[model samples]
Target: MPIGLAPTVRSKFEHHKIDEAALDGAPMFDLPFNPGVQIRGYSAINQPNCQIIIEDFMPGTEFDWTFVHDEMQYCISGEMEVEVSLPPLYMETTKAHITPGTVFSYPVGARKHVKVIGDAPFRHLCFCPPSPDYPFPTLEQLKGS
Candidate 1:
């Protein structure tokens, strides 16, 4: 089939990665957008071409905005509703329910609205290519919750 496998094991891009537990002490940042929502994130991978982060949004939080980087996200836990639309005019919306193992992506400039959908925090792992024009949050931007 087009997708290539049943009960998918891992992404073709997967490689031996550092343990996520090792990043437990990494600094957290009150990520931009979704203001007032208890959403926090910390870099788990900061490579020259790309970066990854584990981000969590407390229940009822909503993040609605356009993308500045091409990116992909995988739900690690909890649930979410994401609405994405291509730019030029983000008039139409494509919504999806994101659960464990759900993977989604959007091109740069696509508009996306994501809402944390349940009691527990909605957590996901996000990956994006690094760009000097719009850099990722630095550890210095960390703050106590």
Candidate 2:
């Protein structure tokens, strides 16, 4: 009943293939204007030291501005446009266009938005540090929640 044990259980399970089909029919977060499928995620080093999530963005849909402890992302399937806002400075930097196979990382307090284009969906993986005070709510509890 202690923390940081789920990852061990997950590791014990067989590794499965990562493919579009595997992601199909998956449950995703739908927030009015934003549309994306959250494929899979894991709590790093056990219960929740860090988390990794794979998302598929629908065309014209976006993940709105939100702050995190820290984040790193990689484009795995399609194209996207990312807009980031930094705190203290309130400065906004935008990556107008990004294609498949691109990778990037952001600081702990960055606010970010993601937009997908064309008919194809944008698939990417996100990494974020585990912190109790992360502005964005953690999905860690959803493993049971």
Worst 10 residues of 1 by lDDT: 9-18
Per-residue C-alpha lDDT of model 1 across residues 13-51, encoded as one tens digit per residue? 424343334333444445567555555566655665667
- TM-score per candidate, chains pooled: 0.70, 0.63
- lDDT value, candidate 2, whole model: 0.59
Best by TM-score: 1
> What TM-score quantifies how close candidate 2 is to the native fold?
0.63
What is the total number of backbone clashes in candidate 1?
0
Poorly placed runs, candidate 2 (over 4 Å): 1-16, 32-47, 131-145
Best by lDDT: 1
Q: In candidate 1, which residue ranges exceed 4 Å CA deviation?
A: 1-29, 131-145
21-61: candidate 2 lDDT, tens digit per residue: 44544455555433443323322222254555556677767
